[model samples]
Target: MVNLKLKLSEKANYLAFLIVFVSLGLASQSILAEEVHEPAEQIAPHQEQFEAGKFVIEHVSDAFEWHILTYKQHHISIPLPIILYSNNSGLNIFWSSKFEHGHASYHNFRIEEEGEHAGKIVELNEAGAVVGLPIDLSITKTVAGIFISVFILIFIFLKVAKSATSSTGRAPTGIQNLLEPIILFIRDEVALPTLGKDKSERFLPYLLTLFFFILIENLVGLIPIFPFGANVTGNIGVTMVLALFTFVITTFSGNKHYWKEIYNPDVPWWLKYPLPLMPIVELTGVFTKPFVLMVRLFANMMAGHMIVTVFVSLIFIFGQIGGPALGGAVSPVSIAFSVFILLLDVLVSFIQAYVFTLLSALYFGMATSDHH
Candidate 1:
């Protein structure tokens, strides 16, 4: 009996130690998982919405259709989707097509065919044209906003410019008072420094217009709602068109001196002649310069937006399965980084606009300069 009692006591002690070891293992695992899982989950929300927004921008047609059949069906249409989040409901998805004006029950439609949902595979009629066009009233809203913004800026500036020339040498009043300093700065600092007093005045109108237009558009894109978030400057086509205008203006404004410099550059004899290849290479540089301008602005703007979106997405992906503890751990980090990027984006907005305008003015100055 004594031996049996001793054996039982030993067994109980062993079991207690085993429980402690198992509990320690699980506790460590939970800690590690929380650390690893938090950031990914925190970023998920930003990622999901950003990708969804980018997809919509890439696929959604801006072309307006007057009638249902007259709809220009270049690509398949998915019902207009929106991402909604609030403290009360968490996250919700809504389709604009599902809701009717003043009606309560939402009628949502899903894509029956693969192309329709994914925005691929256009259907063409016998005349080899698109069968139907997606109704794009959204674009009109965007256009209206752009027009209003442009009109306001232009009207205000034109008034300011006119005031600067008016009877009294004293500064203008009202909106003119607000904008006078910026205009003078552009003229004195940007233009005079780079293009000189004589040539700078000639290009001032275009430089100011470009700068203000881009600045407003970049700010508007940050709104992240309907009639906004159109990625105006980030759109390659828009940048290309703007670049083309600059190219045309520069080309037409080019004096005999500009052409002489390109065709007969003042270089070392070896480089100027270069057997036969130097002329060809030198000529190519002229075209390549404006092309670089188009690509640089578009790429920088698009890339910054994409990176911010990716970081924000980590929250959504990890949070879905992580529950509270893991999600909470990651949210702060993701939000912090997103805020950092947002601040950087603000600087980038101005920098990019300034660079584009500055380079354009530089080109114009060179084009119109008198021969040495």
Candidate 2:
């Protein structure tokens, strides 16, 4: 009996040791896996300087150079032209690479990293007060994006025109085939219905340009790739310019009736006699119409870009905290959401273009209406 008891005790001791050994082995394996997968160099800096909001805002905002991606300690970027016109320097033109990614200054000019003039070119005096402000006509990332979109537009339209002339009534082919229906859709569904056949004919060119320009910019901004991804339409300046064009066209197209409608609105006699309330309200609307256009486009496009960028940033944030395994686990969820937003943004791009065009056409129609 004593021998049997000793044998059983020996077996139990061996079993306990085996279990401890297996647990230790599994734990070591996990640690090794994490060490192997964690990208220490890439994530460490980001973790040190990680301000989630700042990271997100920077990605959405315009930059002097086009930042493509980063690997290790290297940043792959394309430096754009930094064209500046200053009182002292006249025309100072150079590639943005001279700034060494905003580290070094050149020719008494530097890219402002903070304050109201952040991301702008400002010339400082010896005491550091801004003395000479340069007119920055630089081909910034946004400008480069605009140039790319314009080139695409010119290329596509030229091809479409050539096809229209050369095909000689044959069915449209290639890009022409795809875009013809869209163009026709714009004319038939949007232009004719809003501006009437005659007015639509008069304003079709402008409306078409407006529609396609916004559509193309929105699509390009969504790409997040080189020479294409820029928040041009999302920029308030760009949207304001577009709105200004609509405002100017509407103002020019306004006939006597359109003016009379605002200045001497057909309202209750009391409303006009005492206060000109109707006219005042109508006048406010004239300006407000364009303001709404500018805000709507800028806000919508910017929001979409921000959301996608934020989701992408999450992967890095997780990696910084729990190493690559946690980051890898979160990536699938993050990417799925981003892809869904991107698809939604695609539809929004078209809708926004259509809405802007439709409203512009409607405004034109109202201005040109003879019945009023």
Candidate 3:
């Protein structure tokens, strides 16, 4: 009797399972039918919506305005000045808002939305062809960052200088108290070791300025806020300018021994006279040094910003593919890694700045080194 009852219960459970299985199959079939009936245009819109890489590129690249954040369908951004000059246009000055965030053209000029010129201001003809290159000396996001950094540096140093003068023989106080140790460290620890005590004094001001500028720019980049965090150090143009300064200083300051080592390196006589291999190699090293400096700082800073952005993007990527539950599950892991990298990036910021300044000083030492 117990076996008979168990058999009956198993039959009932099987029947209930079949009903659910059939229901799901029918529901899926209906969904498929509806999708087939829908027009291609309807599906095309969905395909355009999930673009992760685009988001990454847009965030890192320089823009005319500063995009703060997006809420729902509205984008909040600070408009910057758009200064353009062309043979035809003469000088067209306007706010970036005139372009409506790249949605419309203004005065026969539009920010290129696609292609190689994307994100750049170009003059357009009646036929919509790019007619001329506009000199875009406008104050862009990166430029704004530079201005802010310069202002801050000037303000801080000026305040400290005033305090030192006013205090006279008394102990240092306020901003002077804070900056004194750092300035001393760069002088005694960095410059003295690399350029020696006597020579370091002459270049101490420039070295100090270089170190502080890089350090401040790096710190500001990690903020991820408005009116700041413009990736100034990451921009190749800015890095190139910094490297050029080092190169110029090293070239002008090079002594007899320095040029002698390059043009007449202590190598096999055959290498110098016949092939001029040693001299050629040494001469090549001169340009390569600054090239390395430019590439190193630019690559490191840009890479850090890209990595942090990619990690944060993972959450949205998961949500798009696997629904909200999967996104929620991935959030903790993504945020954890991002935070860890951010902390490491802070350390990198100091290290990069020190490395740059230290290298510059070393080059200076080598350039001015006295040889018997």
Query: What are the clash counts of all predictions, listed in order?
Result: 21, 0, 0
- Superposition TM-score, candidate 3 onto the true structure: 0.85
Return the TM-score for each candidate structure. Answer: 0.62, 0.85, 0.85
RMSD of 3: 22.9
The global Cα lDDT (0 to 1) of model 3 is 0.76
lDDT per model, in order? 0.55, 0.76, 0.76
- In candidate 3, what residue range of length 10 has the lowest lDDT sum? 27-36
Please give, for residues 145-209, the per-residue lDDT of candidate 1 as tens digits: 34444544555544554554562556457765765565556667787887887777566766666
**For residue 181, what is the lDDT in candidate 2?**
75
What is the lDDT, from 0 to 100, of the residue 172 in candidate 1?
53
Per-residue accuracy of model 3 over 1-372 as CA lDDT, tens digit each: 222222322332333233223322211110000001222333343334557788888788788877777554456777777778888869887777777778778998999988888778889998888986787767777777776666666666666666776777778888778767777777778889989877976766667767877887998888887657889889898788778878999999999999999999888799888789999999999999999999999999999988988998999899888988998999999999999988898999989988898899999999998896
Per-residue CA lDDT of model 2 for 121-190, tens digit only, reads 8897666667756977776666667667766776666666666667754776887678767777887899
Candidate 3 runs further than 4 Å off: 1-48, 168-174
